[model samples]
Target: MNVKNVYIAYTNCITPLGFDVDSNVQAIANGVSGIRLQENSTLMTAPFYAGVIDSDKLNTAFAALSDAKATRLEKMMVLALDPIIKKSGVELNAKTALILSTTKGNITVLNENAVPVPDAYLHQLAQNIVDFFGFTTQPIVVSNACVSGIMAVSVAKRLVQAGLYDNVFVISGDEVSEFVLSGFNSFQAMSDVPCKPYSANRKGVTLGEAAAAALVTINNSEAKAKIAGDGSINDANHISGPSRTGEGLVRSIESAFNEAGVTAQNIDYISAHGTATPFNDEMEAVAFNRLGLNEVPVNSLKGYYGHTLGASGLLETVIGLESMARNKVFASMGYDEPGVSQPINVLAANLDTPVNCFLKTASGFGGCNTAVVFQKVNNGR
Candidate 1:
């Protein structure tokens, strides 16, 4: 397939730190943590904090849409689209593709008995967004666990490369519900305090709810972040766990570099998937070191955005692009002490560096991992 030119035209996010893309970038630049105790009684039952969107504001935004029975994910997808469609100045055409990424699609509607829970969840999500926007093309929903968002971008690029569509809208969103929160808690992975990824005092994870959307196109335009290269792989070692040695991550990073025709030395900054859990952080450290990228300035946005689960990959990618454009890398907020033995350089202070190429990676529960390489306009060597 031809390697099509893909640009991230617009990104919108809803996290505890901020709602729009600009606000989120500013919060990260300031090393602001988005995790906080859930003020809602419904969310307060869980011990850990989350990067939750403002419910009242979200509801207000959702209510403006025409669909009366739109699910939470549907609402979020709508919210994500508003900014892009508005900013692009390109009218929402029927030919534009809609590629959605979400592991738990509309799990919030299951308890209400408003829909068939798991089986029809994904279909509902796709159709709801398509119907709302009145798109002529069929909607594609990718449910690849945590790697869904990154994979969505990869798929869009492939499609455009093959000359299938000119525009692709990718949305990644998931809500924090009893089912998801309890499952993580049962695994004893819920952090009582805010999550501290890649830190010596790191404990467990804190669940976060987030919605992120990016607009991409084959057309090279002035208003988007270009997609340089991307890679993905499966561990095949475990079904619901990451490899202890981070073997899959290593391969994925290598593959991404190869696709970009660049080497490890070319990446100046790495947006790592630092989940703060013991195994995840250590495995990432080993994987990064093995790839000879140990000295690369690395920071995990999990400290700022908490783990947005399905939305983590894309949300972090957005942050990486914004940081690179501004030529500033922010420190990992929750890191107090070093955790791993490997010589990984975790950012301790925001640094002004000439960032050219960046690698964004994410590893999920299903032994899936992906890496995406990006370069600034006129910045690639």
Candidate 2:
């Protein structure tokens, strides 16, 4: 079998912060956060903080696309993918695949008055988007808890390597619905303010919603970031929490390192999955310490976008790629003092240091952990 190099060719983002990557990155560069205090009696009896997109703004963006008929979630997904597909100028043929990543696909339909076809089925969500864009191949939906985003990318790379497709477009999204809000609230995991990841006074998580898309292709010449390696492992530690000792995360990172022929020393930075939860942050710290990556500068995008569920992994990866292109390391927002017991270099301020290679990681419910290695394309190292 012939192995092909996978490269992220184009990217797009639609989040509470902004509708496109440039706007969102600028917001981060200026220390702006999308998270805000929200009041929805149906979702929660009391006020809660969350990163939620404005309904009017979403409608405007979707209206601009002449797709006003799509549901809010579907609009976000299509709005995310349309730009990348246009930018890539890649035709949707039999060899080109479309992948949708989300934990909840139109789950809001359950609480809304609109009755959708094949209602609430994730497959229908993917089909709706692909059907709009005229993809010849069957739509693929990935919904593995919060790992859905990066997992979709990993799956796309593997499929491309196996000659199932020459190009794959992965779009991941999840809306901040009443169901999700109540679910997190039930866990006592909803923070009252913008999350402070890896901070001494950190609280719990602030949920967010977003849709992001990237084109992964075998053509490395026009690549933004090269997908060097990727891996996933499950410890079955708990249903909603990660391993206390970071066993699964460590193994996942090691697997990617082995496949990419890189080491802890080779990594320039870590795009950590710091959810701002006490146990989650500590577990990530332990993992980095055990892997000899204690000093690697790391930041969690959650401080800006909050925990965006399945969209987070892909959203952060897209921003990480932008960081490499610009040579600017955005600060881990809301981080002041180290709270985790282990020694981990959590970024407190933005660094202008040049980055060549970085690791993106995500640990989700059901003890699923995934890590992927990416290197800057055409960097003059």
Best by lDDT: 2
Cα lDDT of model 2 by residue, 80-118, tens digit = 999889888898998899999999888878775556537
For model 1, how big is the CA root-mean-square deviation? 2.4
Q: Which ranges of candidate 2 are over 4 A from the true structure?
A: 113-117, 379-381
User: Can you give the TM-score per candidate against the true fold?
Assistant: 0.93, 0.97
lDDT of each: 0.80, 0.90
Candidate 2 TM-score over all chains jointly: 0.97
Stretch of 10 with least lDDT, candidate 2: 110-119
lDDT of 1 by residue, 261-345 (tens): 8888889899998888888888899999999999999998887877888888888887888777888888987888899878799
Task: Note the residue pairs that clash in candidate 2.
Answer: none
Q: What is the lDDT of residue 258 in candidate 2?
A: 92
Global Cα RMSD, each model:
2.4, 1.6
